[model samples]
Target: MKCADGGGGGGGGDTEAEDGGGVNVTLTTTTLPS
Candidate 1:
């Protein structure tokens, strides 16, 4: 399956998105220059 690709550039993107949102949140919070 394309989702099984090593690049993680396929159906797995959705899963990553869910799993990665926390990273984005922390990034935004830290980068906000508070």
Candidate 2:
């Protein structure tokens, strides 16, 4: 059960990470211009 839960959570985490990465890139670009 634990292994199954971890696998599911890992997939969700990857999607969140991709979204977070895009936001981070945008923030860094805005900061660099200032």
Candidate 3:
């Protein structure tokens, strides 16, 4: 579950307090480039 928490943080917010869609898109883009 730690990885899930980290994903939210890496996405930008501690949880869904921020725009999840934007964060998800950012994460996807970053993951693809590497």
Candidate 4:
């Protein structure tokens, strides 16, 4: 489980915070050993 504590007042909210609407946002990631 996770949480998103955001305070984006239309700046990034109007930008990077998108999905299948043309943009994408990955909130978490895990990198396996190369």
Output the number of the lDDT-best candidate: 3
Among all windows of 10 consecutive residues in model 1, the one with the lowest summed lDDT is 1-10
In candidate 3, what are the lDDT values of residues 1-34, reduced to their tens digit?
4445546555565355466654765566556544
lDDT (Cα, tens digit) per residue for candidate 2, span 1-34 = 4444444444555566855654554455445544
Candidate 3 stretches greater than 4 Å from native: 1-18
| Model 4 stretches astray by more than 4 angstroms | 1-9, 16-34
TM-score: which candidate is best? 2
lDDT tens digits by residue: candidate 1, 1-34:
3222323333344566754754554444444533
| Tens digit of per-residue lDDT, candidate 4, span 1-25 | 1122222222344554444222222
Candidate that beats the other on TM-score, 2 or 4, i.e. the better one: 2
RMSD of each: 11.0, 12.9, 5.8, 7.6
How well does candidate 2 score on lDDT at residue 33?
A: 47
TM-score to true structure, per model: 0.34, 0.40, 0.35, 0.15
Better of 1 and 4 by TM-score: 1
lDDT of each: 0.44, 0.51, 0.55, 0.28
